[model samples]
Target: MDVAELTGTYTYRSFLNRPEPVDDFNKLRFAQLELRLTAEPDGTVSGELVFSEGEPGGDTIGMDMVGRASGASPFAFTLTGKGRPGSPVADFHYEYDGVILRHWDIGIGQLMTLAGTVLRAEDHGSGATLARAGQTASFLAVKRQA
Candidate 1:
């Protein structure tokens, strides 16, 4: 997949693992994410996922995360992330394998531009799905605040 294809801002609600409670997935609500993906000729993607405390208009109370994905295609890729959640004591990092499956047939395929599902971090029994109408819904394009 090309960077321009996925070139846009996206909002997402992630279930953060509460390290103090043995890595439990807690509902991180009203959180927004901005992803800028650049496709490299080597079939790898370099990007940054910025996590904000509230909407873009609000103050950034949390940390900003950065990660990279490498794969033959964007549908199925591996991502590794590391960042601090606005705290000096806590650290955030994880690796996940994601695949874009057909919504009807469930067959592996290239992720659809502007519309698709991404399964990230499946360690918690089931991976999180970031898609339309989900708890985490992000605009694929950059939002220009007025």
Candidate 2:
């Protein structure tokens, strides 16, 4: 399918594969995400990602997103979104790559393979070379029907 075809809501889930079992490792392992986006003809992207974690009535947070799609066959894309807002201590930087599987019958819903690194704004640029790097994770999500 084409990137333009992905203009709706999708349920996204990613698994963390970190070498060290840090305190935040559990966060990535036990979260469910929902992405609602509109793909423009020019490849512009606008969306919001809702993340739910913990128990049934657990915490849920929203992130604002804007991105662009590239390539034709694989429909690779880059998304830059912010979560937690002005609260520096609670904020996060999300960066990821996504590829909608060419085949649909392989998984539960429209299969999408995703991988990316998530870090704090401070853990960037030349200064960050000495600081600890960000965390990386990869997983698959299925696009749900409208």
Best by lDDT: 2
- RMSD per prediction, one decimal? 11.2, 6.4
Instruction: Kindly list the per-residue Cα lDDT of model 1 for residues 2-118, writing each as its tens digit.
Output: 433433344433443333554333343333466545555454655555654556686543334333434334355444544544543124444434443323456555334232222
User: Model 1 misses residue 121 by how many Å?
Assistant: 9.0
> Which residue ranges in model 1 land beyond 4 Å of their true spot?
1-4, 15-32, 53-74, 84-90, 100-146
Per-candidate local distance difference test: 0.40, 0.63
Task: Report the Cα lDDT for residue 71, model 1.
Answer: 38
Worst 10 residues of 1 by lDDT: 130-139
The TM-score values for the models, in the order shown, are: 0.40, 0.65
